[model samples]
Target chain A: MAESRGMFFKSAVVASYALMLAPVVMVIIISFFRQEIISFPPEGLTMQWYVNAWERREFARGFVTSLQVAAIATAIGVPLGTAAAYALARAKLPGREAISTLLLGPLAVPGVVAGTALYMFYLRAETWLDQDITATLSGLVAAHVLLTIPWTVRLVTASLQGMDRSAEEAAANLGARPPTVFMRVTLPMLRPGVVAAALFSFIQSFENLELTLLLVGPGRTTLPVAMLSYLEFRMDPTLAAVATVQILLVTAMMLITDRFVRLSRVI
Target chain B: MAALVLPAALLVFTLLVAPMALLARISLNHYSPTELMVEAFTAENYIRAVADPYYQQVLATTLGVAFLCTVLTVLLGFPAAYWLARMESNRKSIATILTLLPLLVGNVVRSAGWMALLGNEGGINAALRALHLTSGPLQLLYTPGAVIVGITAVVLPYMVLTLAAVIESIPRQAEEAAANLGATASTVFRRVVLPLSLPGVAAGSVLVFILCMNAYATPLLLGGPQFKMMAPAVYDQFVRGNNWPFGAALAFILLVATLVLTVIGSMALSRRYRG
Candidate 1:
C-alpha cells in the first residue's frame, strides 16, 4: 500500500508537469513545421516561417514598442514603488494599512476590468485636456506603471520585513546621516529585492495584453496585442515563430531572475 | 515619509480608484447613441444586465467556469506543490523553473497552442483517428471545456507556486514527529499535513478563482463566439455594442462578484481548517 501510494503521487506529479509543459513544447514544434496551416506531425520541416516572422515589419515594430513601453513603465514605477515600500516598511505613517491596501489594490483587480476602467478615465481626461493620450505609448506606459507598482512595493516591503534593521541603526550610531545610511547601507541590502521587483515589473508590463488592447490605437500595438490580431486574421507558422521568440525572451528573463534572486523567494 | 508615499498615493487615487469610481457612477447613467453617455441617472443598465436571460447565462457560465478551474487547479496543483516543497534545493530549483515557465509565456501564445491542439484537425483528433477511436474530428475547441482546460493550464502554475511557498514554510519536523508517534504515513498526511496546508490551499484558491472569474483572453480565444463569458460580454457592450453604461455595469458586476466570492471562499476554507 505504501509503495502504491508513492507511485500514485509520483505519477500524478509527472502527469501534471507534462500537462503544464505540453502546450509550450507543441508551439515550439509547430514553429518548425513547413505547412502553412497548424497541424501535428508536420509534412516537412523548414526555417522559412522564422524567416518570414522576422521579416514582418509589424512584429518587429511591436517588439520594439513593447520593449520601450515595458522599460519606461519599469523606470517610472520602481522609484515610486521603492520609496513607498520604504515609507511603509520603516516609517510609522498614518493610515498605513489603508495606504498599503491602496497600493496593492491592482493585484486583486482583473487586468481587463482595470484596462476598461482606465480607458474610460482616459476618454474623460482627453475631453478635459483636449489632447489624445489614449492610444499613445505614454498612455500605455502610465497604465503599465499602475500594474507594475504593486509588485515592486509588495516584493520590496516583504524583503524589508525580513531584513535586519540593526545595520541601519549601527550606521546611525556612527554619526552617519539618514540619507547617507539609506544610500550606503539600506539600498545595498535591498539590492536583491529591488532587482527581483524590477524584473517582475518589467515582465508583467511586457506580457500585459488586456490593458494594452483597449488603450492601443491603430498602428501602435504592443507585441501581445499584435500577436492577438495576427491570430484573429490568420493561422500560420509565423505566429508560432513569434511565440517562440517570446518564450525565449521570457526564459532568459526568468533565468536572470534566478541568478540574482531565486524564484521561490520572490513569487 | 510623507513625500515618499504621496506620489504613489496620488497616482493610485487619480488613475486606479478614480476610474473605478467613475465606472461605477457611469454604470448608473443612461446610454446614448449620438452622445456616447448622458449624465441622467438610471439603473437601466443594471436592470438590463439582471433581467436579460442571455446576460444571466453569461454570468452563470462565468461563475461556473471560474469555480471549476479553481477546483481543478487546486487538486492538480496540491501534489505538484508537495513535490516541490519536499525536494532538495538543487532539484527544487529545476522543478520550479519548469513549473513557472508557463506563467512567463504570454496567455495569447499559450491559448493559441490550445487552439492548435484542441481544434478539429488538431493533435488530439490526429491521434484519435490513428488509434481508430472515432471517424471524424471532435468539437473540442470553442467549447466551455476548452476554456476550462486552457484556463486551468494558465493558472495551475500560480496555484502551485502559492501552495509551494506556503508548504515549504511548513516544517518537516511536524510530519516527522507525527510519524514517530506511531501514526501511519497516510494518517499523518491526513490529520497533520493536510490540515496544516489549508492556508496555502485557501490562498491559492482565492487567487486562481479571481483570475479565472475575470478571465478575458483565454475565454475569448479558446471558448470563441459560441461561449460568451462576462469579460468578453463586457467588452462587446463597451466596444462593439457602444453601450458604455451597460459595459460599466457589467465590469463592476464582475469586480464585485469576484471580490465577494474570493472573500467568502477564503473565509470558508480557513474556517473549515480552524476547527
Candidate 2:
C-alpha cells in the first residue's frame, strides 16, 4: 500500500510538471506553423514565422533595446547589490535590519505601484535636472536597475550569511588589504552567488513589462512591452514565435546556470 | 560605498515611499483631471471606495480571486514539494530544475501561452469538442477561471520552492523512527512530517496571497476589462479615468491591506514554527 501510494504521488508530480511546462512547449510548436492566425494545431509546419519575426526591424530594435537595458542594469545592479550585501552582512553597522529592509522593501511594492512612482520621480527629475531623461534609455536603465538591485542584495546577503567568516579573517591577518582580501579570498567563495545574482538581475530586467511600459519611448520598447502592444491590436503566430524564442533563450540560460552553479545557495 | 548605498536608498525612498505619500495626500484633495486647482481636503474618495456598492463588489472579487488562487497553488504545490523532498538525489535534482523552470519565463509569456490554449479555437476547446465533452468552444478565456489558472501557475513554483526548503530541513531520522515503530507511511507523514512542514506551508501561502493581491498582468490579460481588480482599478483611475486622487487612494488601500496580511501571515508562521 505504501509503495503504491508513493507511486501515485510520483505520477501526480510528473503530471503537474507536464502541465506547467506544456504551455511553453506548445508555443514552440506553434511558432513553426505557417498559419498567420494561431490555432490549436498547425496546418503545416514551417520556419516562416521565425524568419518573419527575425526579419521585422521592430523586433530586432526591441531585442537590441532590451539587451542594452538589461546589460546596463545588470552592470550597475550587480556591483551595487554585492556591495550592499557585503556591508549588511559583514559590517555590523548601526540599524542594519532597518537598512536591509529599506533596501529590500521594493519586493513588497507591486510592479504597478513601482512603475507609477518611478514615472512620477522621473518627471520630477527631468524638471530638476533640466533634461529630457524621462523618455530616454538611461531612464529605463535606471528604473530596471532599481527593480533588479533589491533581489540581488537579498540573494547575495543570504549567501554571505551562510558562509564562514574565518577565511576572510585569515586573509586579513596575512597582511592583505580589504580590496585584496575581497578580490582573492572572499570573491572566489562568493562567485556562485554573484553569478546567480547577475543572471537574476539580467532576467528581471529582460522580462520587465510594467515599469518598461511606463518608461519606454517610441524606439525604446522591450520585447515584452512590444509583445503586449502587438497583442493589443493583433493576434498572430508572430507572438508565438517571439515567445518561443524567449523561452529557448531563458531555458538555455537556466541550463547553463544550473550546470555551473547551485541556485539554492543564492536564492 | 556609503555613497552607493545612499543613492539607491534615497531613490527607493523618494520613488517608492514618497509617491505613496503623494497618493495619500491626493486622495484627500478634491481635484479633477481637467482642473488643476484643488478646492479642499475631503474624505469623499475614501468614502466612495468604502461605501459604494460597485467598489465593494470589485474589492470582494479581488479578494475572492486572490484567495482561490492561493488555495489552489498550495494544494497543487504540496504534493510536488513533498515528492521532491523525499525523492532520490538524481530525481530530486531534475525535479528541482523542472520546478524552477517556470520562473525563467516571464508572466507575460506564460499569460500569452494561456491565451492561445484557452482561446476559442485553442487546443483545450478543440480536444473537448472532439471528445464530445462540449458542443462549442467554452467561454474559457477572459473569465475569472482563467485568471485563477494563470495566477496559480505563476505562483505555484514559489510555493513548491519554499515548502521544499522547509521540508528538506526536517531530519529524516524522525520519519524513520515513525516508520520503525510500525506506523504506516501515511500515518508517519500525517503524524510527523505534516506538523513539521506547517511553517513552510504557511510561508508559501502568505507569499502567494500577497503576490495575488498585487498581481496585474494575469488579470489584465485573462480577466479582461470587465473583471476588475484593485491594482487595475488603480491604474484606470490614474491613466484612463484621469482621477489621480481616487487612484492614489486605491493604491494606498491596496498596499496597506497587502502589508497587513503579510505581517499577520509571518506572525502566524513564526508562532507555528516555535510551537
Candidate 3:
C-alpha cells in the first residue's frame, strides 16, 4: 500500500506539471495552425498567423515601445538600485530595516493602485511644469523604473550579502581612494549581481501591464497592452502568434543568460 | 553609504511615496464634472464605498476569489514542490527551468491562452463532446470558476518556487529517520516533513494570496464584465467613469486589504513556527 501510494504521489505531480504548462504549450501549437478560429484539433499547420502578426503596424510600434521602455528602465534602475543595495547590506545605519522596507514596499502595492497613484501625481506635475507627461514615453519609462527597482534592490542586496568584502578592504589598505576602490575593485566583484539585476528588471518592466495600463495613452501602448486591446476586440490566432514569439524570445533569453548566471539564484 | 543610497531613495520617494500620498489626498477631495477634481476635502468617497452594497459585493467577491485561488494554488503547488525538492541536482535544475517557463510569458498572453481552452467550443469542450461527455458546450469562460483557474495557473509557480526553496533546505536524514522507525510513507510526510515545511507553506501562501488579491489581467479577461473585482472596479471608476476620488478610495481599500491580510498571515505563521 505504501509503495502504491508513492507511485500515486509521483504520478500526481507529473500530471500537475503537465497541467501547469499546458496552456502555453497548446497556444504555441495552435499558433502554427491554419484555422481562423482558436479551437483545438487545429485545422492544419501553417505559418501564416506568425507572418500576419508581424505585419500589424500597431504590434510593431508597441514592440518598439516596450523595448525602449524596458531598456531605459533597466539602465536607470540597475545602478541606483545596486548602489542602494550595497549601502543597505554594508552600511551600519539607523533605521536600516525601515529604509529597506520602504524601498521594497511598491512590490506589495497592487499594480492598479501604483498606476492610479502615479497617474494622479503626473496630472498635478503636468500643470506645474506646464507640460503633459501622461501618455509620454518618459512617463512610461519612469513608471517602469518604479516597477523594476525593487527587484534590483532585493536581488542585488542578496548577492552583496554573499559577496566577500576582504578584497575591497585590501584595496582600501593599499591607499586607493574610496572612488577608486569602488570603481576598480568593488564594481568588478559586483558585476554578476549587477548584470543579473539588470536582466531581471528588464524582464519585469517588459511584462508589466497593470502599472502601465493607466499611464499608456493613445498611440503609445506597449506590446502587452496591444495584445490586451486586440484580445478585447477580437479573439484570433494572431494573439497565439504573438504569444509564440514572446515564448521564443524569453526562452532564448533564459538559455543565453543561464550560461553566465544561475537564474534561480537571483529569483 | 548615505550618499550612495540617496539617488534611489529620492526616486522612490518622489515616484512611489509622493504618488501614494497624493492618492490618499485625492480620495478625500471632491470630484467635479467640469474641474475634474476640486480641492475640497471630504470623506464622501470612502463613505460611498462603504455604504454601497454594490461596492461591498464586489469587495467580497474579490476577496472570496482571491482566498479561493490562494488555497487552491498552495494545495496544487505542494506536491509539485515536493517533487522538485526531492529530485537530483541535474534533474532538478532542468525541471525548475521548465516549471518557471510560464512565468516568463506575460499574464495577458497566458489569460488569452486560457480563454481559448476554457471557452465554449474551445479545446476542452471539443474534447468533452468527442467523448460524449456533454451534448452541448458547458459554460466555462467568464465565470468565477474561470477566474479562479486563470489566477491559480498564474500564481502556482510562485507558490511552488517559494515552497521548494524552503523544502530543499530541509535535510533528508529526518525523513529517512522517520521511515527507519517503521513509519509509513504517509506518516513520514505528515509528521516529519509537514512540520518542518510549515514555514514554506506559510511563505508561499502569503505570496500567492497577495498576488491573487492584486490580480488584474486574469479577472479582467477571464471573469468578464459581470464579475467585478476591486482592481477592475477601480480601473472602471478612474478611467471609464472619470471618478478619480472614488477610484483612489477603492485603490486604497485594495491596498489596505492586502497589507492587513499579509501582516496577519505572517504573524500567525510565525507564531505557529514558534509554538
Candidate 4:
C-alpha cells in the first residue's frame, strides 16, 4: 500500500509537470509551423517563422535594448543592493526595520502605480530641467533599475542573514582590515546571493512591461513592449516564434546558472 | 555605513515616496491634456471616483478577479508545493526550476501566450472541440475566466516558490514518527503536515493575493478594454482621460488596499507560525 501510494504521488507529479509544460510545448510546436495564424494542428513544419523572427530588425533592436537596459540596471542595482544589505545586516542603524520595510515596499506597490508615479515624476523633471527625459532611453533604464533594486536588496539581505557571523570574526582575528576581510571573506561567502540577485535583476528588468510601458520611448522599446505592440496589431506565429526563442534562452541560462549555484539557497 | 544608508534612503524617498507625494498633491489639483498644468485644487475627482457607479463596478470587478485568482493559485499551488516538499532532494530541485519557468517569461509574454491560447481559434478552443468537450468554441477569450487563468499562471510560480521554501523547512521525522505510531497517512498529513505547513500556506496565499490584486498586464491583454481592473482603470484615467488627480486618487486607494492586505497577510502568517 505504501509503495503504491508513493508511485501514485510520483505519477501525480509527472502529470502536474505535463500540465505545466503543455502550453510551452504547444507554443514551440506552433512556432515551427509555416502557417501565419497559430491554429491547433500545423499544415507543415518550417523554419520560416524563426527566419522571419531573426530578420525582423525591430525584434533585434528590442532584444539589444532589453539587454542593455537589464545590464545597466543590474550594474547599478547590485552594488547598492549589496551595500544596503550589508548595512542592514551588520550595522547599528536607526529605523532599521522601517528602512528595510521601505526598501521592500516597492514590491507591494503595483507596477502600474510605480510606472505611473515614475512617469509623473519624470515628466515633472523634464519640465524642471527643460529636457526631454520622458521619451529618453535613460528614463526607461532608470525606472527598471528602481523597480528591480528592492529584489536584489531583499535577496542579498536574506543570504547575508543566513551566513555565519563567526567567519567574519575569525577574519578580523587574523588581523585582516575590515575592507580586506569584506573583500576576501564576506564577498566570497555572499557570492551565491549576489549572483542570484544579479540574475533576478536581469530577469526582472528584461521581463518588465508595466513599468517599461509607461517609460518606453517611441524608438526605444524593449522586447516585451515591442511584443505587446505586435500583439495589439497582429497575432501570429512570429510572436510565438519570438517567445519560443526567449523561453529557450532563459531556460538554458537558468539551467546553466543552477549548475553552478543553486537558486533555492539564495531566493 | 551612514553614507550607504543615507543615499539608499534618499533614493527610495525621491523615487518611491516623492512621486506618491507629488501624486497626492496633484490629486488635489485639476488638469487636462489640453492644459499642461492646472493650478487649482479640487475634490471633484475624488468625489467623481466615489460617486460614479462605473468606477465602483470597476473596483468590484478588479477585486473580484484578483480574489478568484488568489484562491485558484492557492488551491493549485498548495498541493504541488506539498508534493515538492515531500519529494527527494533531486526531484525537489527539478520541480523548483520547473515552477520558476513561468516567472522567466514574465507578465507580458506570459499574457501574450495566454492571448494566443485563449483566442477564438486558439489551442484551448481547438482542444475542447477536438475532445468533444464542447459543441463549439465557447466564448472563453476576453472573459474574466481567461483573465483569471492568465493571472493565476503568472502568479502561480510565486505561490509555489514561497510555499515550497517554507514547507521544505519542515522536518520529515515528524511525519514519519506520526506514521510509525500507527496513524494513517491521511491522518498524519492532516494532523502533522498540514498544521506545520500553515505558515507557508498563509505566506503563499498572501503573496498571491497581493500580486493578483495589483496585476495589470494580464487583465489588460486577456480581458481587453471590456474588462477593467484597478491598475488598468488607473491607466485609462491618466493616459486616456488625462485626469491625473482622479488617477492619483485611484492609485492611492490601490496602495492603501495593498498595504492593508500585506499587513493582514503578515499577521495571519505570523500567527500561523506561532500556532
Candidate 5:
C-alpha cells in the first residue's frame, strides 16, 4: 500500500514539473507553425516566422542595443558589486545587514516604480545640467546597471560565505599585501562565483523590461521591449520564433555557465 | 576595507536614493496637464489616489489576484518541493536545473506561451471543442482567471525553490520519528513536516505575493487593456497621460502596500509558529 502511494506521489510531482514547463514547450512548438493566426493544431510547419522575425529591423536593432547595454552594465556592475559583497562579508562593517539590504533592496522594488522615478529624476537632472539624460543610451544603461547590482551582490556574497578562509589567512601571514593577496589567491578561488555572477547579471540586464520601457528612446529599444511593442501590433508566431531563439540563447549560456559553476547553487 | 564598498555605495545612493527622493518629492506636487507638473505642497495626489473609485477597484483587483496566486502556488508547490527536498544528489541537480530554467527566460516570452495556450483559438479551447466538452470556444483569455494563472506560473518556481531549501534542512528522522510513533504517513506529514516548514511558507508567500502585486507583463498580456492593475496603472500615468506627479504618487502607494502586506504576512506566520 505504501509503495503504491509513493509511486502516486512521484507521478504527481512529475506532472507538476510538466505543467511548469508547458508554456516554454508550447512557445517552441508554436514557432514552427505555418499558420499566422495560430489555431489549435498547426496544420503545417514552416521556418517562415524565423525568417520574418529576422527580417524585422526593430528586432535586429533592439538585439544590438540590448547586447551593448547588458555587456556594459555587467562589466561595471560585477566588479563594484563584487567589492561590495566582499566588504559586507569580510569587512565586518557597522550595520552590515542594513547596508546589505539597502544595496539589494532594488530587487524587491517594482521595476515600473523604479523606472518612473528614474525617468522623472533624469528629466530634472537634464534641466539642471542643460543636457539630455532621458531616452538616451547612457541613461538606459545607468538604469540597467541598477538591475545588475543586486544579483552580483547576492551570488558573490553566497560564494564568499561558503569559501575557506585558510588560504587568505596564510597569504596574510606571508607578508603579502591585501591587494596582492586578493589578486593572486582569493580572486582565483572566487573565479567560479564571479563568472556566475557576471553571466546572470548580463542575462538580467538583457531581459529586463519594466525598468527599460520608459528609458528607451525612439531608436534605442532593447529586445524584450521591442518584442513587447511588436506584440502591440501583431500577435503571431513571429514572437514565438523570437522567443524560441531567446530560449535557445539562454539555454546555451546556461550550459556554458554550468560548466564553470554549478548554476543551480547560486541561482 | 570600507573603501571596497564605496563604488557600489556611490552607485546605488546616487542613482536609487537620489532618484527615489526626487520621486517622493514629486508625488507631493500637483500634476498640470499643460505644464507637466507645478511645484506645490499639497496632499492632492495621495488624496486623489485614495478617493478615486477606479483606483480603489484597481487596488482591490491587485490584492485579489495576488492573494489567489499566493494560495495556489503554495498548495501546488509544496508537493513538488517536498519531492525535490527528498531526492538524491544525482537526480536532484538535474531536477533543480529544470526548475530554475523558466526563471532565466524572460516573463514576456513565457506570457506569449500563455497567450497562445489560452487564446480563443488556442490549444486549450481547441482541445475542449475536439473533446465535445464545449460547443464553442470559452472566454479563457482576457479574464481574472488568466491573470491569476500567469502570475502563479511566474512565482511558482520561487516558492518551490524556497520551500525545498527549507525542507531539505528538516532531518529525515523527524518524519521517521513521527511514523515510528504510530502516526500514519499523512499524519506524519501533517503534524511533523507541515509545522516545520512554516518559515519557508511565510517567506515564499511574501515573495510570491510581492511579485504578483507588481506583475506588469503577465497581466498586460493576459488581462487585456480594460483590466487594470497597480503596475500597469502606474505606467499608464507616465506614458499615456504624461502625468509624472500622479504616477509618482501611485508608484509610492504600490511600494508601501507591497511592503506592508509582506510584513504583516510574516508576522502572522511567525506568531502562529511561536504558538
Candidate 6:
C-alpha cells in the first residue's frame, strides 16, 4: 500500500510538470498549424504563420522598438543600480533599509496602476514642459528603465552578499586609489553579478507589457504590446509562431546566462 | 559612497513616487467630461466607488479568485516543488530550467497560450470529444474558472521556485526518522514534511496571492470583458472610461487591499503553525 501511494505521489509530480509545460509546448506546436481557426486535429502543419508574423509591419516595428528600449533601459539602469547596490552594501549609509525599500518599491506596485499613474503624470509633464512626452520613445524608455532597475538591484545585491571583499580590501591596503581599486578589482569580481543583472534587466524590460501597454502610443508598440494588439483583432496561429520565437529568444539567453552564472543562486 | 545612489534614487523618484503622488491628488478631484478633471478636494470618488454595488462585487470576486488560486497553487506546487528539491542528477538542472521557462515568458504570452488551450475549439475540448466525454464543447474559456486557471499557471512557477528553495533546506533525516519510528507514510508527511514546509507554504501563498490580487493580463485575457477584477476595472476606468479620479481611487483601493490581506494571511499562517 505504501509503495502504491509513493507511486501515486510520483505520478502527481509528473502530472504537475505536464501542467507547467503543456501550454507553452502547445503554443510551439500550434505555430505550425495550417488552419487559422485552430480547430480539432490541428488540420496540418505549416511554417506559413511564421512567415506571416515576420511579414507583419507592426511586429517588425515592435521588435525593433522593444530592442532599442530594452537595450537603452538596461544600459542606463544597470550601472545606476550597480552603483546603488554597492553603496547600500558598503556605504554604511543611514536609513539603508529605507533606501533599499524605496528603490525596490516599484516591484510591489501593480504594473497597471504604475502604468496608469505614469501615463497621467506624463500628461501633466507634457503640459508643464510645453512638449510632447507621453507618446514619445523617451517616455517609454523611462518607463522601462523603472522595470530594469529593480532586477539589477536584486541580482547584484545577491551576488554582492556572496562576494569576498578581501580582494578590494587588499587592493585598498596596497595604496590603490578608490577609482583604481573599484575599476581594476571590484568590477572584475562583480562580473557574474553584473552580467546576470544585465541579462535579467533586459529580459524584464523586454517582456514587460502591463507597464508598457498604456504608455505605448500609436506607432510605438513593444513586441508584447504588438502581440496583445494582434490578439485583440485576431485569434490565429500567427501569434503562436511569434510567441515561439520569443520563447526561443528567452531560452537562448537563459542558456547563455547559465553558462556563466547559476540563476538559482541570485534569482 | 552614498552619493553614488543618486542616479537611481532620482529615476525612481521621478517615475514612481511623483507619479503616484499626482495620481493620489487626481483621485481627490472630480472628473468632468469637458475638462478631463476639475480640481477639487473631495472624497466623492472613493465614496462613489465604495458605495457602488458593482464595484463592491468586483472587489469581492477579485478577492475570492485570488484566495482560491493562492490555495490551489500552494497545493499543486508542493509535489512538484518536492521533486524539484530532491532531484539527484544533471536532470535537476534541466527540470529547474523547465520550471523557469514559463516565468521568463510574460504573463500576456502565457495567457495567450492558455487561451488557445482552453477555447471551445481548443485542445481540451478536442480531447473531450475524442474520448466521448461530452456532446458539446465545454464552456471553458471566458469564465471565472478560466481566469483562475490562467492566473494559477502564471504564478505557479513562482510558488514552485519559492517552495523548492525552502524545501531544499529541510533535511531528509526528519522524514526518515519519523518513518523509522513506525509512522505511516501519511503521518510522516503530516508530522514532518508538512510542518517543516509551512513557512515555504506561507511565503509562496502570500507572494502568489499578491500577484493574483493585482493581476491584469490573465484576468483580462481569460475572463473576457464581462468579468470584472480590480486591476482590469482600474484599467477600464482610466483607459476606456477616461475617468481618472475614479481610476486613481480604484488603484489605491486595490493596493491597500493587497497589502492588508497579505499581511493578515501571513500572520495567520505563522500564528497557526507555530508548532
List model 3 lDDT by residue over A64-171, tens digit each.
999999999999989889888988887786788887887797787778888899999999999999997988999999999887779889988887788888999999
User: Candidate 1 lDDT, tens digit per residue, B54-127?
Assistant: 98999999999999989889888988899998989987888888998988787888887887788887878888
Interface RMSD of each: 1.4, 2.2, 1.5, 2.3, 1.6, 1.3
Model 6 spans > 4 angstroms off: none
Which 10 consecutive positions of candidate 1 chain B have the poorest summed lDDT? B112-121
lDDT of 4 by residue, A1-267 (tens): 878876765665554455455556666777887879777767898888888887887788888898899999888877887888888888898889999888887776678788888889988999899998776778877777776668878888888888898989999999999899889999899888888888878888888887777777777889988887787666688887888877887787678768756766555
Alpha-carbon error at B260 in model 2, in Å?
2.2
DockQ of each: 0.70, 0.52, 0.67, 0.51, 0.66, 0.70
The best-first sequence of candidates by TM-score reads 1, 6, 5, 3, 2, 4
Clashes of 3: 0
Model 3, B28-141: lDDT tens digits are 999888988788889999889988999999989988988898887877888899998888876776787787778878788788888888888687898999999999999998
Docking class of 3: medium
Score every model by TM-score.
Answer: 0.97, 0.93, 0.96, 0.93, 0.96, 0.97
Q: Which lDDT value does model 1 have at B147?
A: 92
Give the alpha-carbon lDDT of every model: 0.88, 0.79, 0.85, 0.79, 0.87, 0.88
Model 6 C-alpha lDDT versus the unseen true structure = 0.88
Residue-wise lDDT of candidate 5 within A106-208, one digit each (tens)? 7977787788888888888999999988777899888888888888899889889899999999999999999998999888988888998898888889889
In model 1, where do residues sit more than 4 Å from their true spots? none
- How would you encode candidate 5's per-residue C-alpha lDDT over B215-270 as one tens digit per residue? 99988888987889999999999899888888899999999999999999999999
Q: What TM-score does prediction 4 earn? A: 0.93
